[model samples]
Target: MERGNRIIYNQDGKIILQTGETTGDVSGHDTITELHYLDVEYGSIDYNKQHIESINPITKELVLKDIPVILTDEQKRLKALEEELSMLKEENKNRDSEIVNTAFEVVNMKLNNNI
Candidate 1:
């Protein structure tokens, strides 16, 4: 019995799964069970970040792994600035709350003196 249609690899060993292009099949191709994408919260994995770590022989699934990236100097600086901006926003929110409370207290004092 045939398991399934095996994935076709080009001369460079890259998988050819194009939409319309047709390539003749040859022998010695692996039947890929599943193709996985990197699961991360911050950003979707791009081509540069995607690395094929290994393929499970039993499962016939290609494992996708994340490649560690070192941030450039400009990237590091931008990140620092973002963090500082977040902290400043929080500080402003707290100050606004304090100002409103002080204003309420002063108004209450004036009302009591008039009473």
Candidate 2:
């Protein structure tokens, strides 16, 4: 989420913070430029909290849990669209090849008939 922020400007003379790749130009009616992510340097404290259960008992269990990452709905939709586009492109390629082959065959047949 942190890497998804971009700066945007509005018609009302207000600056907006869009949390994604931003489109549109700074001045309206102009060509849109490719957007880039804003790099941010984060501050951090070099410290940690270390605690033991039962006043430092003979044995203790420290469980580390990691959250699972899942794809966003938009990402899923885009992936599906990409697959569909790829399939369409493949179909078009096959159709074009067939048309070319048919044309070649027709030309060859005409040449043979003339001979």
TM-score of each: 0.43, 0.27
lDDT of 1: 0.72
Every model: Cα RMSD to truth: 10.7, 20.8
Question: Who wins the TM-score comparison?
Answer: 1
What residue runs in model 2 are displaced by over 4 Å at the alpha carbon? Answer: 1-69, 101-115
Ten contiguous residues minimizing lDDT sum, candidate 2: 50-59
**Model 2: what TM-score?**
0.27
Candidate 1 regions exceeding 4 Å error are 1-48, 97-115
Estimate every model's Cα lDDT from 0 to 1.
0.72, 0.59
Give the count of colliding residue pairs in each prediction: 0, 0
What is candidate 1's CA lDDT for residue 78?
99
The alpha-carbon lDDT assigned to residue 42 of candidate 2 equals 45
